[model samples]
Target: MAFRKTLLAAALALSLGVSAGPAQAEVKIGFLATLSGSGAALGQDMVDGFNLALEERGGKLGGQDIVLLKEDDQLKPDVGVQAVQKFLEKDKVDLVAGVTFSNVMMAIAKPLADAGMTFVGSNAGPAPLAGAQCNPGFFFAAWQNDGQAEVLGQFATDRKYEDVYLITPNYQSGRDQVKGFTRFYKGRISGEVYTQLGQQDYSAELLALQAANPSAVWVFLPGGMGVNFVKQYKQFGLMGKIPLLAASTVDGSTLPALGETALGVYAGTFWGPDFQNPVSQAFVAAFEKKYNRIPSQYAAQSYDSALLIDSALQKTGGKIDDKQAFRDALRAADYASVRGAYKFNVNGFPIENFYAFEVAKDAQGRVSLKTIAQPLTDHADAYAGNCKY
Candidate 1:
């Protein structure tokens, strides 16, 4: 009779949306990130940064041994969906982590939520996730799809860049960027251009840009696309002749490839390699030491994701089976984020400061990003109010 009661209790716990806790002091997490083709550097940084955080604790989180199952999304929505399904049906991970693009997140979010899975995303927060379509257990550690774009808009306004043109890959995130920029930009838009997702050559686009002859151009190109665009822009003699602004175009991941050509390019972000704070300083130093390269915003966010999981597990006494308990601990957000100031909004997005960065040569004559100005302080997203859950 006692044995029967034990089984019944376990069954009851499972039915009530609570985790029964792992049989052993072990937690399995499925980590998926884009790791091939065009934007692979961004994906590699995300994986390496998250691994560094785990290694710091001797491959443990909250006193429990962590089993990380990694997958490469290949930067495709269909591929990402398949990887996520494997995590659900085969690995049975306690939580899912690391998505490089918003499209992949959109493909995987619903299925994971439907399976009562907790997705601790480190990058790519689509607007709907912060608004009407929020999932109960989905948490994005990075800023929303529009967060940096909104900052770019404010930066443009502060600089008084009139007749600013826009260019981005034609995707949901691309559209979101334009929308967010227009929200705060008080200037006339010279034009808007959308290109293919992984377009390598921007020669044609650059020709059109020259014809437009806008006072300034703001772009959302990232990874190889950013490198190609900047190189072509320079070849077209538009680098210094026209003011080029962006959010993720010339970042740590692509800066090396761009070299001096990417110099003087301004971008907006919530954190950078030069972000000053003890926690951030340590992370940046440790990351550079291990990887021998400056960590990108993607890396910073993924590192935070690892910290978030560790902190939440600690709060739960190393128990991740309790769904609400784990989520609540995550909501508490007890870890010292590398970004210095970070808090999850009601929709599980962040409200933080944003800054404009210029790629400059430091005293050592090494290329690095220098924070020029703060565009937005304590900024929250516009769609959070509409989030139902």
Candidate 2:
């Protein structure tokens, strides 16, 4: 009887211990991006960068096990909204990250804000979110929608590129790109053309640009759109006729496919592999060693996003529920980033220096970008003045 009672007690104790074993509470992070279609490359890069950071940090954020729920918005605003809704209402994600397009970010911003969920944008810095509609919950890990374009515009002005033609997609973000370019570009405006969003064909636009014969062309086509534009631009023989000065999109993500065609393109960006900082150097080396390719500004931005989250969590002692405290910690910018120096703007966007880069073949004969100049010094986006939060 005694032996049976002891065995029963042992079994009960084992069951209780199993039941009480460290209550695993999962912190779900929803990553919504254009996983298919034209923007898939950018999304894939972001995922790669994000996962790299997570792996480096041992798959934990804020001292908790992270459960990442990935959804492909396919560059559609409606799909983005639906994905965000599902994440917030059903999956109960602690945060939403990795939006690639401004339109998609705009669509889900207010809803995510209302839900009191943290929206950490790995890319897609729309103007509205930086300005009047800015919310405490929305933090941009990338530059503001127009910040890099504004840098490009200033670079063109300094170079005396008169009669510049501007081309961008006909979307809210595209419009903002043109506006940003014009804001600092004091030279004569040749013409402004807005193409359909994600339009694969740019032949008509090229013809128009050729007829205008602008001294320089400024374009803001990212992801697949950039791929299509560069290919079409080359086919039309516009590469030799006019110089192209564009945002980072021109070569950062498209260079692998663009190959020799991306040569001689000037791009302005906030981060690049050529940055001479120790942190950036180590990051570039490690990233290349692991991925067997150079990392783009997109990857750098996403990597920073993950590190920022980790830093904030560490600051708050890994408390995810203290949203206000978490935001404060993130705003403090306590972590070291590969970008060298970056701090949050009053509107929660990054306040970082912007550099102008030229696409050129490296010693290894691989196409890469080289930084020429820092166009913006301690720059702040124009929209930040309007933000109350």
Candidate 3:
């Protein structure tokens, strides 16, 4: 009877959150993204990238099994906040990653910082976190909100576009992008329009743009919004009349739908299908084999995020509870990135390159983004100057 009682007590202790041994320990990660609605494609690609990395590692990171919980933010701040609250307060997850949209990230950045949880952001680099509000726990594995846009703006300046019109979704990222574009483009402002976020119908905006007839039109729409806007712009027969220069408006995420219609649309990016590096080649081949679609900047950034986590875990021997050690390990960024060159700046955002890409048909006659011009090399975010640590 005594032996049976002791065994029962041990079982009770194990059930009450006592780990029997190190073998039983696992890393709990909560990955939240806008997995539905207008931003679904971007979030889906990010999830795929992270999953592919885990699959390659046999579903383990840093020698410990990962207990990953994926949640959909639905592109709404309130919904994202509720989901993050559960991850931080209830589940007590060790890490947080994969936020596809900026609005959701803006909503939860503060809470994650106050709780002292690390966010290995795969996407969505909001400007505030890269500046005065920067925190040690928030590491963005993607470009700053304005970095790519600044490249596009510089491209426009190089081309000597005299009058340019800007259109973007009305949100934090949208504002940041426009600010980046105008930061370099020494051009006369023809017009500026901010559309409702996640808006599907862009007829009014397209018509207004045609009426303006500026020397060039710059936009920052992504995902479904890009698809709809490009289709409408073509339908309204304004394709060749005014040049379209964009950032995130014409890329792998929307190219499947836009097809030949998106051909010749110029956009700015950091990675694409044509990257020749061995790491990039392997990642693209594996992603294509697994997903049967071309990997976009979305996938590349998220893939780097997973790789960064794996490398950091290797340094810490899979231990994540020691906040400073894990933070230091991540800061080291000892990993082979899918993008050619990658490292975190003082602000925790990436110091990388951005380039110009054009929508064109490859040898196989399928529409793809092709590298065109070198825009910004070893580019750091404009906000990094304000960050201390």
List CA RMSD, all candidates.
6.5, 3.7, 4.8
Write candidate 3's Cα lDDT for 165-258 as tens digits: 9999999999999999999899988998999998989888888888888899999998999999989888988787788887877877889989
Instruction: Report residue 30 deviation for candidate 3 (angstroms).
Output: 0.6
State each candidate's clash count.
1, 0, 0
Instruction: Give the alpha carbon lDDT tens digit for every residue of 102-147 in model 1.
Output: 8888888888888999889888888888899987688888888898
Ranking by lDDT: 1, 3, 2
What is residue 312's positional error in candidate 3, in angstroms?
0.4
- What would the per-residue lDDT of candidate 2 be over residues 162-224, giving only the tens digit for each residue? 779998888878988888899999999999999888789988899999899999999998888
- Candidate 3 clash pair list: none
> Which parts of model 1 are misplaced by more than 4 Å?
1-24
Q: Where in model 3 is the C-alpha error above 4 Å?
A: 1-21
